[model samples]
Target: MKNLAWLSLGLMIGQFAYADPIENGISFTSGDWEIVCDNTRTCRAAGYQNEDDGTQQPVSVLLTRAAGKNQAVVGQIRLGATDTDPTDTEVQMKINGQNFGKVSISKDGDFLGHLSSAQVEGILSSVKKTSLIDFIGKQQKWRVSDKGVAAVLLKMDDVQGRINTTGAIVKKGALTEANVLPALPKPLITTVKVKSSPVQWNSTQLSQLRAALKATFKSDDDACSMLTDPQEGASEISITRLNDQKLLTSALCWRAAYNEGYGYWVIDAKAPYHPVLVTTDASDYQEGKITSAQKGRGVGDCWSSESWAWDGKQFIHTGASTTGECKAVAAGGTWNLPTFVSTVR
Candidate 1:
């Protein structure tokens, strides 16, 4: 439910982005580092170079740990634009000027392979204090800030119930990892099979459907009110059979410079069509699932998305996530961080 303005303000003022109505799990940020714990309790901590530091390119790191006793804390690194080939270049991490070792290149551009356990441990110890984190490559050196990293990792530890345990990332103690909380099982969702392929409404049905949906809007200024008169010739609607008794519908709701939105609803196939509006800002619909993808800004550097699925009875939120802050790291943003996750059967 957050927008570009709120995201920018939170980062600038060093305010944490708490879980919003759209997001179900824990969403927190502090300084140059932030962490997200999904519904399954898996935590991901991302740290970046201070945006104000213009002298060098952006260098970032990702640390991930699933909820459970003794789960390994995996580390990943990403570098900003460079002149040389990443494969041929040897990228090494240096904590406070101490060389840890080189990290392997990854198939994903700008991202290095998973860090070795030793490298991860070194990072866990160094990131807690006012240390300078650096990733060195040919003609490139990315310095990540240590500010707020300790607080973020501590929060991760707290959420995972790892605090005061041997496996705690920030507050390690004498307690055994067995004392830490176990990972929760992923929520299971049995998807409804599509009874038939997609089909659009005829001209007669289209006009009636539009009028019916317009009636549900709060006012003439509702964003989706564009359904009456789209920027194009007219709005379009798609109908698909959800089951023998119900039908799924989609229609063009609004448009923007680089992105668009759709309205999704569940309705009866016959007259007395009780259109149950799902969302007016959905991005796409397929089979028995509905999804929405929105950009933090027009550049497409940062993004967020959520999904809903039919489970025979009704649509349920399946997942919601966002790439880390829009630091202009890459086109789709720096990381695939999720605030909510689920396993759909």
Candidate 2:
């Protein structure tokens, strides 16, 4: 999964001041407005705003047009992390102070609404003339600039194959009405039974384990430091047998200075002399599989986790989940489980 560390509203928005220029797909920029085509060829235009005190607001507006005929022209308004119930409120859009429409909030806490082709054209035309768009929620407002929107949409059409080299043009049309939004699959829940008893290692065994760990970190200076001088009271080492006679040992070193940690050395019982260091930070191994997680904090906290199975030679990522909403503070939270990405078997 792509790292969701950027989901931290404050940290992410702050970095946007120095964000890199777009390199892939079609990209157009004017003033504070930016439009770009994604890998899927879908085009979206977005604008950001910061408060007078330099504090970043998580509010933004996205205008998207998908490829193909009759594709929906969507307007999306995203807000900062909040525990407020979005379903109880409404979001409105205005072009040049003229009311466009009102929309409901999505499960992701954003307001998304499909627009008619006529509405799209009107908004585009108004932006060119007035160069201002406003998105108003119950208690917040976002002002967007439309300076370069016209050129962006035209280029987007060309990239999406809507424009032919023969100077032909495809007109935008109304989208089909749909009542239900697509739903993401639920995460897999498995309760693997692990051994309740802990293993006791003798002095000779401990020495061998240390030797294995040393060999694993010999070429990694950072890893070596983490293993040797980990943060005070934030280190652990353990040995366990996954199967009848296959013992595995692992270690965790927390480095508070980095707000991160490291785990390494998955030694096989039969090959103790040639231990393999885990390339991925996975832990809680059981039944030939291990789980790993990454998290970030700011105005809201976000996390992504995955489970991988060891197939004798390598670990294969099998399942994954992520917290999509920053304010979803329930146990395990609301996870969006998309199809698993490929992993070497």
Candidate 3:
């Protein structure tokens, strides 16, 4: 038993160490169960089984507790991708061939049930003594490994900051710290230098600036439409002095769907302005460099961002950060934080 515990600890720590930080999700294996924890510290434990016909199905049961909620843990039997949608149905559960009880499946194909802490303790007792536990839904059957299920549940409890009085499952030593996922770095904000005596543009100069911007996008009708369209939000164009000799101009147009847009542009130098099209989804200028971020669509999504520094003639990519798969949770949008993949300066 001690050897088994040590082996489990080794596997868990090994996974935590080398696994890509970019993959904001932390996963570890105990017996046949694989446990995954998201940035919000909500975790799920799952195990898969293959059918006799060699088709792999989501015949596994998944367990998770709500973030920061220690009242109850929920269990769900995942329906395979190709499985027929289940209407309201009853799922039968058994431990060591003895009937446990029935859990209700919702209309939207969700096979879920709740377990109080006492109920979890009862199940853990059975799992420690049994080898097979079965989940029989109306159209699916999952035979779970008892030891694996027990180990995963213990780890899940740890991840949610729960302590199991029975040392049977609680991790000891360094492995205990692995329960909590690391917090993501704060968002980077660019600092703009404010000028006491800012440069002001007159009507004629402003007209020349507008003409120059329209000319820059002349080759692309879609981009030019942003400056000419009245329905679009007010033109977001501005000019600033980069230094005593260089001047900077920028324009932005926010679109409708998905908050799409004709992104901002930064034109360096003066009239007959040399425009350098900045194509990042979002950007900020600070410390003589442009930092940009591209947000992902959904939780557990990956994001890519970079910083570019201008070197006299052109902007060069100076640093970048990318994250692995991450899923967002609703705890103040904490899961939206991204794990750094790499940083190069």
Q: Point to the candidate with the largest TM-score.
A: 1
Candidate 1 per-residue lDDT over residues 282-340, each given as its tens digit: 99877778999999899887898999999987888898889887776666887889888
lDDT of 3 at 225: 58
Candidate order, TM-score descending: 1, 2, 3
Q: lDDT (CA) for every model shown?
A: 0.78, 0.50, 0.50
Ranked by lDDT from best down, the candidates are: 1, 3, 2
Q: Pull out the clashing pairs in model 2.
A: none
Best by lDDT: 1
What is the per-residue lDDT of model 3 for residues 317-341, given as tens digits with 9 covering 90 to 100? Answer: 5544433222211111111222222
Candidate 2 lDDT over 186-267, as tens digits, reads 2233343434234668777777676667666545455545555444442456777654544556666544432454564555
Q: Where's the lowest-lDDT run of ten residues in candidate 1?
A: 13-22
In order of listing, the candidates' clash counts read: 0, 0, 6
TM for candidate 2 is: 0.53
Candidate 3 all-Cα RMSD: 12.2
Q: What is the lDDT of residue 106 in candidate 1?
A: 72
- Candidate 1 lDDT at 22 equals 22
TM-score of 3: 0.42
